[model samples]
Target: MEILWLSEEDVKGSLSMEGTMEAVEEAFREAGRGTVQMPPKSYLIYKKYDGDLRTMPAYLEEMDATGVKVVNVHPENPGSGLPTVMALVILNSPKTGAPIAVMGGTFLTNMRTGAAGAVAAKYLAKKSSKTVGIVGAGAQGRSQLLGLAEAFDIEAVKVADVSLDRCRALEEESRTFLDATFEISTDIKEVCDADILVTTTPSRKPLVKDDWINEGTHINAIGADAAGKEELDPAILRRAKVVVDDVVQATHSGEVNVPLAEGLIALEDIYATIGEVVAGKVPGRTNEDEITVFDSTGLAIQDVATASRVYRTAVEKGLGIRLPFL
Candidate 1:
């Protein structure tokens, strides 16, 4: 009859980028092994507010983790002095289907998302990756940098954004966790010069052109989580080896969603899933000369896997408040 309730700060305090990467990578491995159950994220759009809410539920059988997360995205929230994205997660006992814990999913979501990007790059990016380029110097961009720094020895970074303030802010913030030097610019093309590139913009149209990107670059397309959203030109996917988090989900709501809808690409064009690459079922970075693209839609399994860990660690360290209501 009692459930643990963790605040946003409590959740952040309980989690680490390193631990999250390990959990997310293992979660993908389980997905590759067919031991996880996850449904595509369901969304409810609020046209008036220019925002959308999503529900994601998943169970990782081998990890003994099951949870549902309710998250919202409102790009204009910053104008009102609030975050564009916020979320909450509820963990339940699989045996009895009882709520065991409730925690803030906003930070957890960001970290897990960053973790997913890093996990994808770990297998797909070249071993000699040293430079990183990123579009959209926002929270997700910063998290992506932090995540990449954990996975690779990045010596230099290039950042592109609409706001110089946000770009500078990311550089200052990154100083705490990342030790790389930075170059800030307003041109997306200028930022694409790197061994590894991460695009985090919520562009409905393509921002990165095919010719601007060179060969041997690994791209993490972090935006474009909806049906019509896209970041890279469809041609980039046509030429590069494309990997998605999930086939069904990515088709409807990932970077490839637009391309697939317009017939610019076909389902068979997808080379493999990230899970398959992590599980060693498929080869990664075959020659270091072919481009690689990781299309991430943010899986429910990732959320549950991270949330489950946070709950256990919080319980051991006495981090959250114990509630008697549920």
Candidate 2:
């Protein structure tokens, strides 16, 4: 009954971006084949504060990973000296249903979410893509940028944020992490022309107009994960080859959530889950000129797959504080 305590640093040390990407690819394959056991994520919404808590659980029998993540999205956290999001993961031994570890999940959530974005781009983005645009220069923005770079030979990155300082900070930070040059802009449209576009702001209204997107653009909508949040016009979704991490999750909480709720777009309009493309069940990026949009709601299978990779790494490297209770 040992409970392992893993800090953010330990988790970072235990996981590799490359390894997580491989694991996520497999999860997408299993999910596409309907072999993964993942119920829709359950959420507890609060009306007074306009906050939300989500509990996501998944078991991949084929991959032997099982975990439940409890996360919160409080938009006011930055003003309150906290992050806008926080999470914790409880990893369990699927064989005996024994709890194996409790680890900080903020990093895992961000990295895996970014991994999903990269996975999407791997399938949907044009092979010759090099330039990237990022809307929202926060933590998620950085993750998305790095993830996108992992999949492309990005030569430059264009970024826009409401805060010029944040945008500049992202530019400065990129010097150390990425080889690409960065350009900061106050105008959202300036960033929209990139071959790969990522929207990570938690905007409740559309920010990037539909017309701003040109042909051959691949958008990773990472911001809109709740019912009211939206980053792009529904018309953009209607015209693009819309793919989601999970149809059920996206229908309820992803970028398409509000559009679908309002009858602006039908479920049939969705071409396929990103997993389908990853699994070879569907083709991706068939045409270089087609617009592709990947709606990322952050799948539970990502957590299971990512956590399993982290756990295995921790075991092999002797990375975490293992308690004697087991």
Candidate 3:
């Protein structure tokens, strides 16, 4: 048996934003229809290093796809010239449980996550949305912009970050891929006021306030993927129509976790999952004046769906190294 090994560059080179969005959307639909089996991610915390490792696994029954992702998050890695997050994925055959591919998942993680945000925005955000606001101008922020640009005709982008350098860098980079005007600021209020807001920070406390957001605004809450992390004011959650990626995962670790834990909101308050909305079981935005939020906790099904695409593309293009493993 041969196992294919794909590097980070190989995955990025093979995947496109548009393709990834479509694949992730399909994955959401499958999940909504209860056709996929994805367990909640298991975590291993290292208090000393202030980081955590997560193991995510999923099986798409209809697609006959199965995969596991091992990922880590260390906020202090950047000072040592490393990324804050890194990941690896192993794709396997469902019938025999044989490993078919081992690939770098860091880039895949960013792309799929971005694709999720884009998919949420497609379903939740208004069709006339033109201005986008991004908080935390990191790699994920750039990926969010890339994915959103593919879905919407964004005319302007407002980026907010603690570090002006990061904000400026994101602004400069946006010029290459996005045909939009970019504004860099440290003011969270300015960022939250856009037609569409994307929160990508690892902030434990809420950076956006309830009053900063206007009616009809759509938010993609992408940063808070672990317990105790939240980016939006719980007050915002109370009034907005919240759509989560996965109910189990989102309640435990997504943007809604904090609010749900504090009793600020109830499970019943969440309107629907993005999958439910995508599957047409629930409506997205009913009116122009309704505020909407998509709480994405990054699903394992997304990993497998995206990895499957990368694997097929690699085979067609003769990429990656095929090594005999058995």
Candidate 4:
């Protein structure tokens, strides 16, 4: 069998954040409704190379979309002129168990993650949130900024990174891409002061301080997609109304992985999943003063939903090259 091959450029041109966000929200609702097939991600952590490889698979029951993603996180890749992260997604016919296509997944991964961030913010963040703060001026960092900007009336953006040069570049890049004013800082605390705080770093240590967070700050923790990788102080999680994409996934793979392992918080500490909130089973942001945290481990349902959308859109638009054999 020969499967259709879609390039990174094609995937980039075919899928968009607005559409992905809408589709992913629906996917989450389906997840809450118990119509999705998603198993916890499996990973191979490489301490020698300072990297990790993850395999994520899911089936969107309603959409009949099934796919698996192989992704890697290597913070040192940039020095070798490679991306810090890379991914590949393979879509298959769920009923037939036949391979349908192999598509570029790097961009798909970033977009779905951003969309998940938006979905979380839509429920957990207060309505009046106007400023967005981003930690880690990298791929996920940029996506989180764009995602939050799309959801809220973001007036300004603040970015912080270990490298001042990266922060400055991110400031300029965001100003151009987002068409908004921005500031670069080396202070994580200053960035955390914004109304909506998003952390997307790969650091194993915490960058944010508990005291720096404001009363109503809504934090989207996107960095800790693997075990031991973290960005926020656990104290913030202790006080905030924590919402995860999936408890089973987050406990072993997301920002709460370390915390859960240490016995700091139990499964009951998770206020609700974004899916439950989206499905109206649980209320989001009960009080204006409530500090809410969305711990995103990057669900596979997101990839399935987004990949299905992109695939359908590409097919309709005649965007990709159709292979001869199948």
How many clashes in each structure? 0, 4, 0, 0
lDDT of 4 at 263: 87
What would the per-residue lDDT of candidate 2 be over residues 223-289, giving only the tens digit for each residue?
A: 9888888999999999999999989889988999989989999999999999889989999999989
TM-score of each: 0.99, 0.97, 0.99, 0.96
Worst 10 residues of 2 by lDDT: 15-24
Clash number for model 3? 0
For model 4, the superposed segments whose C-alpha errors exceed 4 Å read: 324-326
lDDT of each: 0.93, 0.89, 0.93, 0.87
* Candidate 1 displacement at residue 225 in angstroms: 0.7
lDDT of 4 by residue, 1-326 (tens): 66777889889988988999988998999999899999898889888998889899999888899999999989899999999878888899999888787789999999999999988999989899888998888888888877777888788888888888988877776776576678888888778878899998887888888999989999999988887877888888899999999999888878888887888778888899999999999999988898999999888899888988888888877787767664
The parts of candidate 1 lying over 4 Å away from their true place are: none
List model 1 lDDT by residue over 45-84, tens digit each.
Answer: 9989988999999999999889899999888999999988
Model 3 lDDT at residue 174: 79
RMSD of each: 0.8, 1.2, 0.7, 1.3
Q: lDDT of model 2 at residue 100?
A: 92
lDDT of 3 by residue, 1-326 (tens): 89999999889888999989988999999998989999899999999998999999999987789999999999999999999999999999999999999999999999999999999999889999999999999999999999999999999999999999999999888799888888889888888878899999889999999999999999999999999999999999999999999999999999999989999999999999888999999989999999999998899999999999999999999999999999
Which should have the higher lDDT, number 1 or number 4? 1
